[model samples]
Target: MDSRNLIRHKTQVVCIGAGPAGLTASYKLCQNQIPVVILETNPIYVGGISRTVNYKGYLFDIGGHRFFSKSQAVEDFWTEILGDEMLTRPRKSRIFYKNKFFDYPLKAMQALLNLGILESILCVASYIESKLFPPKEIRSFEDWVCKNFGKRLYSIFFKTYTEKVWGMSCDEISADWASQRIKGLSLSKAIINSLISPNANQDRAKVTKSLINSFRYPRKGPGQMWEVTAERIKEMGGKLFMGTHVC
Candidate 1:
């Protein structure tokens, strides 16, 4: 690489990666009339994981995203970009257990129907047992979850998937991960809440970041939002160089 042959340019801000954070920062900086350059490693896409993948005639999300943001500014940003193009999608996640699908967020009726009377009884008994004689030392994710949710529920709900995700025994993962992720959520609380309000997440205050009944998404896909945002950035005289790496 010759020094004179190498192209050089100057900007007030040089953003790395055109992911959500990077793109948002560049958009804001350019809006303030500050010169900015965005370097996106991806050659063609803008949204990173949130980018929509299109085939011959099919459209799919690379990694599914729900357009519900805890921040008002984010919500406003989405609205400003897509507006009526956004559609509200209901959450309906299911997990496979014992070769059967179990409704996520624990649908009381579905769990009872799927697990059967005998297994349900055993699970309830196990919950009672855990409460009566919880592990004295709750250091691991397994211990904390077992104490709060019972061994039977933990084995059925959290065990296999957790191991698959982290590639470690339940005891190996830190309890802090569980505590931080599902602080207010517990098996008993979920059961009780279901009996009261089947879809317990009407209020965001009581809901975890992962738990949302419904969320807005662009009609085309999440990529639409970012594409529009990128266009806005370019219109504002922001320099965007896709397929460019920071090295």
Candidate 2:
């Protein structure tokens, strides 16, 4: 064996992926004066799904990642990393169906009006039926949603969109996905919250991620956050090896 071909490296910690979590771990380690190395397969990008793509000078996120968390510590960490570079923007999300747009995190009145009288009545009936005869065993996304919002509402609001985005049938997807994504939110809870007075005690921290009205984003893009983080890590004596794949 050629001695020169034999390479050796040593670090207190080795982080993989270089995505938000990996970068964050490396950053913290570097901050504590610990030697760390980050390995990322993509040579040009540091953030995984959180990366911003530059196409003909137009910047767009790869996965539409948002900077919102139920944890204050996570929020504070983002602020600490980006500081003023983070922009607080009011979230405006909509779903387009049947040549019309409907608000996401759906407003009950707006949804009913948009769905029309007959469909609305059917949806209500479905919800009541679900309440009266809940599924004995919840297995998939379809089951969970049908048990909560009912089959009718799920078809309209969830089925098409979810299938299109995920490229899988709702029945094929795990109930865990629905539970996690729609955590702390249900049709009844949504209606109750909407009916509550505007001045009611609604702590922002306690609000679900889906219901968040505003969120912070890096001025340039979410990629900027990781870019800055990588630089900071480098300055703090951490090594980042891009274009490196780990098996």
Candidate 3:
């Protein structure tokens, strides 16, 4: 073997995939004076699936992935890197159901009122029925959500979009995803929590308080942050090979 190849590498770390997770890891590692190399398979984009794609001056994403971490370290790191370019914007999420739109994270009363009396009555009936005749074991996503929130709500809000995203029937999908994603959330629990503690979702004085109002987004797009970081890495005598595919 060549002497250069035989020599030990001095770099402290090597990270695969230049996506947000990998990039953040590399950034933190380098901050501690450790040499790091980030290997990305895709040459054109450094931000991976979360990266923005520019087409004729219009920006689009593979999917709508918003940055909203409850971690202070994550928030601080993003703010530091992006600086003022990160704008705090309000979240505007909604669910399309039966040719009508409903608030997401479902404010119970509002959702019920919006769903109207007949559907709402059916929803409550289903909930009581499921509770009385609970499945011996929740085996699938549909079964899990239906058992917790009832069939009417699940059919209107979850079934279609989830099927579209996963390309699988809710019955075919495992219940683990539902359990993890909506952990500690139920229609009764939501109503009770909202009534008892109106500010439960507020950004309170406590470090563990939930954030409800706003989120940070890059001025142009998320890709801008990675591009800037790549430039900084190069300025610090690091190598960055854009448009070069690595197997």
Candidate 4:
């Protein structure tokens, strides 16, 4: 690449990518009256994984992007960005395995019944064994999950889905990833919650992200969020360079 052909800009801060986090950073910098420049490789889209694809007047998201958060600040930020345009929708997730539908967050009675009496007994024994004698080293996602939910339950509920989504075996993935995603969730807690408050409020701060029963989303798709945020950033004097790559 020729030096003269390169585009140059002066800014106190430079943000790479126009995803949710990057755009949020730029928006905040602009709010504080700081000079910031954002560089996004994709010229046509801004939300990265959250981007909405338009095909012949139809809109679709790359993946399901739910707007549920336990943090008040996160909720406030989304409301600030797209007020009145967000829709509250019930969360319905289920796993199809062995020709049976299993609820996510695992309803104890339901899951046990679905797995059958013999399998359920084995699962309970496995869970008790894990509680009694856990693996000394917690290194990978497999270790973390097995320790928390037992090998039988982990294999049934988590292993295949996690590998399919992330394209990695449980042993290959770091424990940190599991810790972050499955934090504050345990088999015991889930069972107790299922029995007591089966339909807990999704907005409650105590509700974990994975267990939320409802969430908010933009009318057009999640991309609308970044698009609006980008406009707001520009309105506040922040610069955005699309179709640009940082070398």
| Cα lDDT computed for each candidate against the true fold | 0.80, 0.83, 0.73, 0.85
User: Which lDDT tens digits does candidate 1 get at residues 1-247?
Assistant: 5643332233388889887788889888887677888999999889887888778868887866778776899899888888899889888877898889996655655786799899888888888899999999989999988988778878988888779756789899889888875576666766777678865644533467656678898999888888888999999999899999878
Candidate 4: C-alpha lDDT: 0.85
Best by TM-score, which number?
Answer: 4
Q: For residues 79-163, write the lDDT of model 2, one tens digit per residue.
A: 9989999999988879998887998767776788898999989998999899999999999999999998988999998898889
Candidate 3 Cα outliers beyond 4 Å, as residue runs: 1-11, 130-144, 163-184, 192-211, 237-247
Compare the candidates by lDDT and give the number of the best one: 4
Candidate 1 matches the true fold with a TM-score of 0.74
| Residue range 105-174, candidate 4, lDDT tens digits | 6667789889999999999899989999999999999999999989999998899999987778999999
Candidate 2: stretches off by over 4 Å: 1-11, 166-173, 192-206
Scored by Cα lDDT, where does model 1 land? Answer: 0.80
Q: Lowest lDDT 10-mer window, candidate 4? A: 2-11
- Candidate numbers sorted by TM-score from highest down: 4, 2, 3, 1
Task: Evaluate candidate 2 by giving its C-alpha RMSD to the native, one decimal.
Answer: 5.8
What ranking of all candidate models by lDDT puts the best one first? 4, 2, 1, 3
Question: On lDDT, who's better, 1 or 2?
Answer: 2
Error (Å) of candidate 3 at residue 16 is 1.5
**Model 4 misplaced regions, further than 4 Å:** 1-11, 192-206
Q: Which stretches of model 1 miss by more than 4 angstroms? A: 1-11, 121-152, 159-183, 195-209
Model 1 has how many clashing residue pairs? 0
Angstrom error of the Cα, residue 49, model 2: value is 0.5
